[model samples]
Target: MIELLIEQRRRNLGGGMSVGRVLPFAKRRMVGPFIFFDHIGPLDLVAGIDRSVDVRPHPHIGLSTVTYLFSGEIMHRDSLGYAQAIRPQEVNWMTAGSGITHSERLEKARAIGDHLHGIQAWVALPTADEESAPSFTHYEGNDLPSWSDGGVHGQLIAGSAYGLTASARTHSPLFYVHLELEARATAEIPSAFSERAVYVAKGEVEIGGERLVAGQMAVLKQGASSVSATQPSTVMVLGGEPVGERFLYWNFVSSSQDRLRQASADWKAGRMKLPDADDQEFIPLPEGDPAKPS
Candidate 1:
């Protein structure tokens, strides 16, 4: 059964920061253990426009932030006093073990105009590793594994595939790949991946006998291998070792619901340090949600 990872178009959240869509785990029907996914933007920025997404320091307990950009530039500052600028095709992997806060912003560029496109994903960590100290790494584009087959270009941005591993270090086993196929070209999904999905960014693709256009996500059922394109296209493939069963409440993910509750209270009480820097932004929790019962 091929399920669609419904596309939620970017919604304006003001401050020039908009979220494309928030996909909850329940809606995904349990493809690989990935509980949440967000497609941030293909949004454009104008020259001389002072815009930035300063997420004020907030807390995350048991997850990792995987930042991938196709265009534009972003400056990342975290609680560890780590400051890094990520360009297109690079991966900024930050793990929030017990708790941490940070922010991301668009850096001013010299180009006459600027275009911003990227995806931000939240991967749940294992139960035992939830409280581990925070850490961060930036993988340059050239450091990722790349290959050509059937006239198509592919890059292993994170995790491993086709006997190649990208430099991006991940806690749990996962695969994050970027494939650019030429017109009428074909590429294959290795059988080793425990589970996987195809997200078409540009052009069109055919997977498991179904056609997927830009912005559509085709999530594969278990035991199925191999995905090919009908036209020249670019797609992101993500999969990995299953995380088993867990609960996600707001920004906290844990095997026990009580842990999430405790973390929330700690964050609200200012027990945790917001990620490192002045420009960070914080996302407010929705009102009256029992999961966030203060």
Candidate 2:
């Protein structure tokens, strides 16, 4: 049986880029610590015009941001005085323990024919660690654990899965794996964790007698399950035990609603410090949902 199959919602960000939002739904707020998940373009970008994805500096709290790219590269700058370039298969893990401000844009050669494809997710920290010191780390793809068996190639994207543990520092028990299968290949997803789900990024897959296409998130039923690809496919498996509950407003996530509201007020009052290199520009609170991540 399948728990729930979530269809991605399109959020157009102007400038010819569209993000597929897969979490924080009204029906289900989160899967483990994953409070927010966005699938950014597999889209072709123009040279100078579509070059920079100037998402200006913004504030966040009580969560860790993971940016994984399948195609292009991004420049990440944070208040921790770190400026790092994240390329394909690299992980930019930023922990906004108490609070932090950061910015992201295209890599310097934002050249033409550059395809931007990636998944940016927010993992809510446990309450005890929510106010811990902020930090950032970049994990190269080669440092991560990867394996291939019976025509299925998989890697531990973050956390632990499939008898492999990622070097990426995670505060809680969770699993995130990236898998690719050849045509007509089948793989049994292990039940090592308490909760699990798989998101199809490309190709056709069958789970529980139903076909899941690209952009579909299938929450699995109890125990282990098998996924078979009718054609070449790429998918990501993610989940863990729930971290209790969390409140989210804008990019702020906390176990306390009052804490979240206070962070929102802080942002509105300009209390968060900005990075020196990218200090002047700050994305203001949206008049609409204000639910937008920084």
Candidate 3:
């Protein structure tokens, strides 16, 4: 049985850039620990006209940011005094436990015109780790687990799946996997986790005879057998134990609204620390609470 079907909302993120938002839907705020999900460009950027995937310094609290890319590169800098460049198949995991600031842009060497494609997700921290010390970690593609069998290629980006686990650590139980399938292939999806969903990334997919194209998400009901692809396709599979109810405002997420308000004030008053290199820029706090599904 299928629980829900969601068509991603194409959102313009300024500078003529846009992304497909796939999570925090009104019908279902989250699938497991995932609170926010965005699929960035597979778009073409001109050499002279477009220069970078520039994201200025921003603050986050009570959550972790996960960045996974399929192509291109990004240079990441954080208030924690961390700097690194992430390329295709790499992982950037940043936990904004108590609080943290960071920025992401095109890598200096790869800043020239090119194609960009990736997924960025936000996972809310459990109540216990909301105020824990912030941290950052990077993993190379070869460092994570991957497998090939029966025409299905899969990678465990974080957490455990298919009797294997990735090195990426999280405060809660969750799973994020990327799967690429050959034509006319069927991929088995075990019910190893409490919650799960399938996202069609590059081609056509079907479960229980329901078709899902690129940018569509199918929240599967219990007893999911497998997913079949009509043609060669790329899919992202994610879900896990719920993180419980949490409040959200702009870039901040917390179990207590008071914490969110405090973070908003601290960001506005310049009390929060920022990246040393890009501290000059900060995203202004939004007017009124724009909490989704309101």
Candidate 4:
């Protein structure tokens, strides 16, 4: 059964490039442990597109940033001194235990241009691990588990799903899978988790007989459910046990409001270090009180 339907809202990530932000909705804040989700472009980038479109160094804390691409490439540089280029099906998982600053640049696409599309989700760390040491890991595309059943093909991106466990390290119980369905193909949504949602990333899908187009997400109530592709479609299925209440502001996620304030002040005062390789410029803290949950 469906609980709530969420539509993507446009958010400018600076430099004229905008993304469809789907999570952290006003009515529905968190799904499982996922605190933030952004659907990047399926658009074709023109050669010579402004370098300003690259995401500059930004800070994050108390969460793990997962970046998975469907196409194109993004060079990721983090304060941990890790610089890696992620391509289709690859995953770049960075845990900002206490704090970390990083930047995503369109290094390859900037010259010849390319179709850049991906999903970036932030999983809030459990309260016990919130202050742990920061770390980063990169998983190759072929390293993950993949399965095919009839017309439904799926890859377990992280956590566990369909009895397949991904290689990407996770801090909690969750499931994140990428599914590609042919027209008329069907796949069942796992009922093992306490919370679950299906996001239509491309084409259309029918869940509980409701048609969901691209940019639409259906948060399902506790029960068994499945998705049928109205056409050739791409979808992401994710959810898990709830991590209880979390406070979010800007890029910080924490259970304590005071910690969020401290992070804001740390970044503003240059106490947090920037990416060693890409530290010439960084996104300044927004001009406002840190009381607001962004």
Q: For every model shown, what is its TM-score relative to the native structure?
A: 0.88, 0.94, 0.95, 0.98
> Cα deviation of 226 in candidate 3 (Å)?
1.0
- The lDDT values for all models are 0.72, 0.84, 0.85, 0.92
Which candidate number has the best TM-score?
4
Q: Write the per-residue lDDT of candidate 1 for residues 48-154, one digit (tens) a residue.
A: 65553444456677888888888878778887888898788888888888887777766654245557777777787876787788888898757788889787798
Q: What does candidate 4's lDDT look like per residue over 47-113, in tens digits?
A: 8888789999999999999999889899999999999998988899999999999999998878898
Cα lDDT tens digits, model 3, 242-284, are 9899887888989888888889889999999989877486777
Q: Tell me each candidate's RMSD, in Å, in order.
A: 2.8, 2.3, 1.9, 0.9
lDDT by residue (142-177, candidate 2, tens digit) is 767999988899878788777778898999988887
Model 1: worst 10 consecutive residues (lDDT sum): 285-294
Among the numbered candidates, top lDDT falls to 4
* Residue 92's lDDT in candidate 1: 88
Task: Give stretches of model 1 more than 4 Å off.
Answer: 1-5, 50-53, 109-113, 279-285, 290-294
Q: Model 3 TM-score?
A: 0.95
Rank candidates, TM-score, best first. 4, 3, 2, 1
Which lDDT value does model 4 have at 288?
78
Clashes (N, CA, C under 3 Å) per candidate:
13, 0, 1, 0
Error of 4 at 261 (Å): 0.5
C-alpha-based local distance difference test score of model 1: 0.72
